[model samples]
Target: MVNVGAKMDERMEINILDYRLKVMSIAKPAIERFTHALIDVLFFKSYLSGGCANNQHGFVSVTETDADYSVIVEEEAYKAFEGKSQDVKVNEQTWLPLVASTGPAMVVQNAAGISKIANSVVIPLADRGISVYPLSTYKTDYVLIQEADFDKVCEVLAQNFRITREGHLQSSEIVVEPTRVQKALPSGAGNSRALTHTFDCSDTNTYCMTSMDSKSLEPHGLAIIKALLYSGHQSEVQTSYFFNLSIIEQDISLILNVTLLNKFPAHLFFDNSEYWRLITIGDMPEGVGFRQAGIVAQISEPIASADISEYYISSFYYGHAFVPFDQFDEVRRLLIKKQNSQKAAAAAKLSNGL
Candidate 1:
């Protein structure tokens, strides 16, 4: 077993990806209309073009749950969805992606390590009232911040983290201001109501999280791409409701319904045995732009407190958390406890105000 604590203490590196991304969601019923558009982003040469000056690296992520489909793509790629349907909801904010890693590689086998990495970055940002949308891959975790918050995010996290910019011909280090001091939240702060009422656990399907080398695409890309096309068509039949394909520069991580694993060869992935349950955080009210602070911390803190292994993916409209199958009930229990605690704290504060 790897020493997770020791690993956590290692010097952290965060790469700021140079892409202006937009988050979009499609209602399950409207997914059919976006099938070709989705296919194009995933497979076509035109959509694969990088978002930077070198045109070598770009990012695209698509996630579906029982509630809706969430997509993260370059601002240019978002044109495909324009005027497509009233069912599609798009956030107008432009987001920047920051990829976080500690060592040569992040080992996904250690549950504690994953939670520790998430909490280190998320909790600090949350404390200072900065909103963050976090996504986890097999290799590392991504923190997506609104472009407006980038400067403050740098100010808050610069003390402990080594920040840099990537996706250009030469990488540049982000200079941290030494005189800036971090702020702490007062007792009983933040959006407690949003934390308490915005989440629900999906009891319908169990999922498997797996990954393949980006190089694998060289030989099996066509077959896997065909499977995705078929899966989109199968959406009408409703055999599965959750699938996530996250293609970073060197890694491709997939979260798929266990029932649908047969679509791809077992040998193509690293390990196909782990099972996870879904907890979906409903979309913020329209125009909210995913900027409310402490949402990720509120959901992740309780689970991590229990030492449970969890993964989070924040889409434009929703936030998704996956816990081990056996631990699902326990996670739900922890969340309810946290919700009640927030409610009680809110009530006590109101009484004091009275």
Candidate 2:
């Protein structure tokens, strides 16, 4: 573990280890293909947040829309009927024609919940054209190609997507002791009947202040406050918000917990967009240049890649070295050794100078 003073040397300024990563962009044709574009035709929504039932398996969207693909293929089949031996074709016994099971039929639905039957089902549909993909009875509309056409499509899309290696700042949890937190907070902050909470998680909006007048909360602020209370915090009386959104309203649903325990509430608020959802606290710290660090050491060990994400140091801090927890002890030991080696090298230089 890293000691509080590890490599400190009184270094408080944020040490950013920046690196450049390359990202592949789609070409004009690919862009025109409209990858990851939402159809919103089916509008398949559930009350749940996420799980395997919600998220993807190996590769969920391996479709023509992928930058890794180019062409698309489709097929349509017809049944053949034969005549009976007698002059009267079906007088004796009628015969039925069977269609090939190469691919199954699917349905397509529009925004109005109106449905249409499609000729065939597209597993991962094409990027363009009228197509239908089956997810049980509720079919999603999209441009589709046949699985038999996979190779041709992928050949066109291959390498259209390039990989970029970007440097990142690390993330670390700051477990503030309630005592220390209490000291940090202004007095009279905790003695509040009305809670002022920013209706958004991102701190880019107005701070929330108290509202003693009992009022119905919009659905927006409901979930997080419930979490705070359900965490079993002493919320005999707490503030709330309801974030019921309208199609026309542009307000964001991201509310933040900004109310002080008792004093006037302070925090930022904004509609939670994609960028806000995928950021770290360090990315938007409460104050200027706030950083958190932890220390660990291993006497003798090798590196492991499985636990890199757990080592939350912003990439800005650790360079390209994604130190995993299993190997973190090794890193500490190696760092200590590197320091000793560097000092020895310096001393040798000085001795030679002497």
Candidate 3:
């Protein structure tokens, strides 16, 4: 829905996992033993439907330290292993369980440098809410993501990256809009010391305010204020400042028109230069006497400017507003085209030994 244009790339779906899985950490000194357990469960026990196809084989992350080697496997696989061998001690925990996309994901073998993929491919996808897990190889770096999310992944990579079931490179043009809400703030807020101003809207009584100066307002704050003023689509929001101050009872009732402070949970509007974000979790039902906007929360990541390649993306702020959900097909089309373009560029660089 973001007007990405007509040139859409081809999307291919692959087999992936269905249900969520619990993590089973197997501490075994011999890696071969763990491999044998999985082989036995798959070949002899036949707990899985078939070999990797249809995602019968789930995600397994193994970490090898000097003291111990741990093999974290899927829940179903662990159960099958337990059925086969009762003596093995398996620790089951919910620490960051691997969740793969539904159906077979088209795996792309990108013969590109890790740093290049990190900056060019991974960072862009992450910004668009598409997660790509890069599996490293001797010459080619394999990029894995759920087939369902591949279109969006490809769209984010469009123009600068490429993807092929067979390792071939392609190219395209890409347009990047880095900010969320582009609309300028009201002229009244132009003054630095301004506190609050009420805008005339056709529907609701909207009051816009800044706890601090206009310069202190980050992209996150501006986006929230804009969304509150206008009817737009906002999915997720992230910020670095937290609010704990309490508001007086009468002011809370007058402002939000709710009796229970917990129901209306008022947070102090500070003018301090800090990062703040309001995330629209879900649609609010009719007649629930509260602000239509979603939860307002903040984080601790400092407000700073740094390039994605120069440093870690910890302090970066990227927000999306007015994303067109109705025009999904068009969005996907633009995404795929951009992905091919990126791939072509990367391939060209690799061929020239860049």
Candidate 4:
């Protein structure tokens, strides 16, 4: 059994960001109406004014899946979607982002590191009934929770680990007393026992995960933005299975389909040579909303157990895991085997009527 508290202490350093964020989804067909506004947030409006030390204010992420586009933006940047709520499905509740890093000296070059971090932070929170939306970039992991749950979350986690807020306004560490006993992580703690969902790989597309320092964008930001704007007009690009652009603070990350990636110059990104394949987890049933927990842990744990590296993104509607193109076959086989074993065990239990 894994010691959840010890694992977290060794692997993660977390901060509760000050930004109030919003998660919204728009159908692919309707995204055109707000293209310009989205561009401005990505390029100009998202950046914070002054040297406020927390100039990391402009946070915007747009994730495209087969069904729709999920947009996560800072509350201020959300003004672009105002008055057009009818066209977009916006979650009325505000959310706060918790940034988890592996420290400055450590670099997460594989999915195993990501998996460990997810297991440590996400699993414990899920076990306690906290529903978190997780987003991963090349350099960092973000777990977003409803603003209303902030204090409760801090209290729960502070018992096992120290909690601190990021940004200039609230840089102080959260003061809390340890009230609960730390325990080993339960085996299969994050399994999707209550919901029926299947995992499948994308048949038509492969993806590339890459990123650039936000400052690097200064040289070719407009050209790159224009390329993205024009690429959206292409029917092929519109229908692609997965594409993501996330800008948080000084980090800019992208998960683009090979076809869409061709639109940008090679010099714009690092690690552009590597390719990834997507494993799309079936969407949660209607009415589940984001209340469902451990979805990430279920998928990530299996892959991580196999020592396979994976990048995960959970949008408003669906969850996606991207594995290295060369290792996709192995990862798929492992998941299928795990699935079969679970099914067999389940059938035997049903037969015994236990």
Q: Which candidate is the best by TM-score?
A: 4
Error of 4 at 351 (Å): 1.3
Model 4: worst 10 consecutive residues (lDDT sum)? 104-113
lDDT of 3 by residue, 277-353 (tens): 21111121221111211110010000011111111110001111111223223433433444466578779999999
Ten-residue region with minimum lDDT total, candidate 2: 72-81
The digit string of per-residue lDDT tens for model 4 on 1-354 reads: 223244345544568887899999876688779887787777777445642245455677888766677899888778878678566888888999887666322333455435646555666666666777778787777888888877767766654555668766558666554444444347666445332457877555778888986667768777666554445566665444667888887778888888777767777788788888888776544423676666666677667766677788877777788888899999888888878888898899999996
For residue 217, what is the lDDT in candidate 4? 74
Q: Please provide TM-scores, in order, for all candidate models, with all chains considered together.
A: 0.81, 0.18, 0.27, 0.84
TM-score of predicted model 3?
A: 0.27
lDDT by residue (tens digit), candidate 1, 1-354: 222123223567677888788888887777777887876665452554442232336577888655567888888778898778998888778889887775433323356424655555777787777888787877667888889988888777665566777655777777755666354344335443247336777456778888987657658766665544446456443543667888765667888777677667778888968888888876545422465787778787677767788888876666778888999999999888777887898899999999
lDDT of 4: 0.71
Candidate with the larger TM-score of 1 and 4: 4
lDDT of 2 by residue, 1-354 (tens): 222212322322111112111111122233323321211100111212332233211111111111121111100000011121111111111111101111112222221111121111111112221111111101111222223332332222221111111143453222222222111122212211111111112222122212211112233234333322222233542332111111101111211223322222222222222110111111212211212111111110111111112111111111011223233444445445544665787799999999
Which residues of candidate 4, in runs, are more than 4 Å off?
1-12, 46-56, 103-113, 180-184, 189-195, 213-219, 226-239, 284-288
